[model samples]
Target: MNPKNWQLSFFRREQRSLFGEILDWMLTPLLLLWPVSLALTWLVAQGLANKPFDRALIYNAQALAQLVKLSPDQQRVQFNLPQPASELLRADDADLVYYQVIGPKGEILGGDRDLPQPQEDEKLGSYEVKIRDDEMRSLEVRVAYTWVQLASDKSPVGMGPVLVQVAETREKRSVLATEIIKGVMLPQFAILPLAVLLVWLALVRGIKPLSELEERIRARKSDDLSPLDEKAVPLEVAPLVSSVNDLLGRLKDSIATQKRFLADAAHQLKTPLAGLRMQADLAQRKDASEEELKHSLKQIGRASVQATHTVNQLLSLARAEGGGAIDLQSCDMEALVSEVLHDSLPRAMDKGLDLGYDGVDTDSKRRFLKVQGNPTLLKEMIRNLVDNAIHYTPSTEERIGVITVRLLVDPYSQALAVQVEDNGPGIAAAERERIFEPFYRALGSNVDGSGLGLPIVREIAQRHGATVSVDVAHPGQTPPGACFTIRFARASNKFKTNMASGSADL
Candidate 1:
């Protein structure tokens, strides 16, 4: 990484705090609105400050217009202000006021002549106020003026109406407007800091539950996988707590599985290794004949084979349990079952057992035994079941052992099933569930094999969304034979509905 970018990345990774993030989002808008609030407040203050003062200015101009009248001959205008009214207009110490009265032909009649003239089109009977510079006097003034028709057609000389203009220094309006603005805005200057402080406090309190949850988790022992108390958390945080609890549950199961696998593997390896060591010791003894040495070597070879088989089964079980999700696709269950039966036929023949596949509509063209699964794992599952049957079933002098693999689809439920049945000493009710556990074997059956077969079958079955169940084929019969069946769910068994009618294809 570039040095600057790497530093930024490290800083971000170290300070990924939820509280800081939330606080930033919460306070940014408030701080941004502070300036906006000042702008709006300033506007409202200016409007209020101009209200009473503008009314007073307009009244003074109207009162001064009352003094103007046309001369007796109606040729000129006369205007004069009373002393009391003049004193009232000049009452303020901070502001200086000046006024002017203009006659009908734009001649100044009274007050300061330097005052500016009103516009010809300016509306009469309403005060018009504007701030402009007095260029002759070199100063700025706020001016309010209006035109007054003092006489009703008393002058037929075609002269325009008289004008009364008032001008004042802006110091008083500025001071009053500033006072109003400060009155409204000063409180908020103090309140903004307090508001931000309260917001920070509320945010800290809001996230207290998360801190407590972290503390609770840290207090737990390494092996303690119990769930957190979701009820104790706020409603907004319950979902996060629930997800954490789910992760803990899965981790607990995975850890338990690992422990069981290790224990079983150690036990399985110990027995064969002890046997191999003993057989080798016997072969190396001083007075051992050639035949005895050969027997010991044979026993050692068998022990080695058993050890290798145990190791392979352990690896298979681990892979089935811990591997990523299977890549499920359309799999022909009948074809997979037939292949397993063919592979196990030689062993079946050697043991004089009748072993074959009974796929429904095998000779016909209809596809009845199709499912969705990983084909390799599905085959491994079936091979394990068939191997277990071949290992456990014994042939008698009168009748050979019968082990048959069958595949069928139920028309009504649309469920697909693969079954392996053997006329061997059946599994007891107590051991049926335990037989699927790793390194667990049926009681009183001297079977020469690793006990990982059924567990592997079960794990693979579960991965394919299938259930494996064992039941007595001939309940209350002499042998009470066992049948192991793997039933695929209807939802996953794609061909069951299509092949429900059982019509053979042409």
Candidate 2:
């Protein structure tokens, strides 16, 4: 596939939907936190397990040290351990306890002969160790060892050192610690899921306003362009909603303007149309005198022509206002002007006016003043300008009015300009601006016109990225008439061909 298609496909595949994205964001951290919580709980349990076990061994060792006594010879040490204390030190069931007493020289004094000695450098403090029993069962055990000074004289009665060591298997401690961890971790496990569930619920609740807004919009009619209520909207959504309302306000204004224009156009058309019908009926009356009949017929013909002109102008304006629905094609301005002038030939001849297509080149290269625009609208614009020129120019045997249509192409500016000049009474500077408005005819002009022609031309020119303006055809000269110039910007090769071919018919 091409790069654009490939990129679109990749984007589609990588698109993470809204709900999925939210769920991933909400759940991933919680999942990662679960392992961290477990590790922390294990560390705490291990730390706590050592405390009680160390205390038990310390108590045993201290009791056993008290039972130690020196013999008279002072060379031997004796242990007078009590039966209750001995029983307390004995292993219950399969659990094992070991105790030992040693001389300063590291000789074993009491308890099991097989019991291991504490390391010589081992501090007089409690610690935990793992060891094997007579049954070969591995056990985690705690040991406490301490040295005592014996009372002695003349080689000392009990001055030499004696060590007391006590140890017990950790099966009971293991069970107790396991129970403690279960008590602590089980509730947390339950609460973890509950916490996740609560978080998901809260996210859904927080997003409820957006869903309500969607529903409200979906329920609205297509034509409804009214602003939405913003008072109760969430702060995060208010800005977007306000922008939408602003867009709706603009659209409402556009729709209202179009409706008013349509109403005005109807009103303008109805009045003349009614008069034309009435005049036609009067002309058809059988009993009318010849003079009366002739006058009625002339009035009917004038009204009919006026109505036709008005209708044509209205159609041109409508076409220009239809926006981008019209296709823009390449056209030759010179050829288009020639065709328009040819079409106006009979009208000019009837008035004995001098009509001509000036500056038209026969060579295709020089003749092709190409432009990109809707050809039909382009022709209508030219026809209107030329027609307006023809209607305003005076016709007399002494000096005939001349209407010239010219096309000029400027390659450096990429522009095509069409000019229609007439030798007639020119409009005043102030009236020139108002002449392009619909139904706005100049005060002294005797020519019949709908006044929509110039406006339609202006609209068509604008739609094609062109500018239309009126100026003097012959400045500082007597009998100077109005010159209408349309300058189209940005002519391209493709546009040239389309417009040229389309305007061939015009």
Candidate 3:
């Protein structure tokens, strides 16, 4: 894929989508609270419009009740009202007024007798408002009713209580209620949108810093892996910026490591290739004897072998560097060491060196001696250590050399260790660490091999969560020999099961 497409895919896979989540949190509360506020405002408006008009309707009914009287025979009722007293009832210009008076027999006696009756259980001398239809038309009105007795108490008491009710068409009350509702809600209608708009603008401003950060990232060159400035971001976003900066720093180090590896690989490959070319040229010369040509061919073969070894080591190092999950199966250190020793026996015999194994040989303890690692890489690591010992230990005409391979577990630490020791010229303390670096050989050593073996040993040991170090085999002796040791982190559980089975079989 192209760079742009690759970057897009990378971010899609790696980064969380943040915009929709932020917007949902900001706007959900505003939408829910808007309708709640409108309902509360409507309730308050209804109460405000009803207070004064209810009292006015009650006062008029009390006055009309005072005009009632009983006849001389006390069998009938009469209500006498002067003109001015009656005119006060229709005083409101916007609404028609209504009133009713009833005798003891439930007969309508005065003023808009068609008024709707109250329920039979309605309490006397109480004021209420209702919306109802009358003989004239349907209207909303306030209602008040009261009981009155005549002046002659004895016969009129038997005649029963007089009834007076006052009512009005509801244009005035409705107008007042509507006015109150508008007063409360109109300002909110204007302010609510303004508030929403202000909130929208605030959200936009809040996210502006993210846009700036994106633009800064987009402006950088493809190869630029510098850290982002965390202080430039909001405090809430600083953690995200810090994480991104850490990733960039690691990526930079990885790229630098790859570049160095490539450079070192090229430099190591050059010498063997030049020797092959020069040897081939010598074999083609007309003046060369048969023996000379044979020697030239032999030299070319040796150079080819060295080049192939270097290439194999490079591939092994690359596999170790590639970070991924590796299956760490239970490994038989003794068996693994034995296989490597068998492979290196021929080389040791050619050098006339004594090569042997050391450590626990009992069946029970031996079966328990296991490590966790990739079997192939573990074997490769053992092979490199044994091969290095065989190659470096000197076998001169005066004295024979010796190399020992040991597989032992530390009693106290419970750590499994693989050790390869040689009684040849040991490495100096100053160069011990450097010897593990790729293509770096110890000074004054003229061994005819690629310098990749020890480095490969160290890299593979590290991949298996093991540590590799060198120490003198015989301290304070002449030509103190070298011992390369690899100590693993933990033991394999399968080892115990295998040991138990072995014990039972025996």
Which has the greatest lDDT?
1
Cα distance off (Å), candidate 3, residue 451:
2.7
2 or 3: which has the higher lDDT?
3
TM-score quality measure for candidate 2: 0.61
> Model 2, stretches more than 4 Å misplaced?
1-239, 246-250, 283-286, 289-302, 323-339, 358-372, 409-412, 489-506
In TM-score terms, candidate 3 sits at 0.78
Quantify all predictions' global Cα lDDT against the true fold.
Answer: 0.80, 0.75, 0.77
Q: What is the alpha-carbon lDDT of model 1 when measured against the actual structure? A: 0.80
| Candidate 2, 29-114: lDDT as tens digits | 98898889878877787668767767766777777778888777766678788788788689477457877787767777777666
lDDT of 1 at 61: 77
Stretches of model 3 off by over 4 angstroms after superposition? 1-39, 62-82, 101-113, 120-137, 144-164, 323-339, 342-346, 349-354, 358-376, 395-401, 410-413, 476-479, 490-506
Residue-by-residue lDDT tens digits, candidate 1, 1-506: 69999888877856568988898998999999989998997888777876677777777777777777777776667887788888888888987889988887878888899887755665564233333334326656667677666543654444567788777876777788899889988999899999989999999999999899889999999989999999999999999999999988888878887887898889999999999999999999999999999999999999999999999889888878864567889998878877788888998999999997766664332364678888888888999999999899999789789998877665546577777888898889899999998777787988787889999999999888888888887767879888887878653334432232221121
lDDT of candidate 3 over 1-506, digit per residue (tens): 79999888877865554665666676688778878877886777666766687678777888887788777665578888788888878777987888888877888879876787766665353223333333335666666667665546565345666778887776776788889878888898898788877877887898899999999999999999989999999999999999999889878866876786687679878999999999999999999999999999999999999889888877777666645557889988888888888888988998899998886756645755787789988898889888888888988778779898876653434656677888899999899999988778899998877678887887788778888878888778778889887768553444322221221111
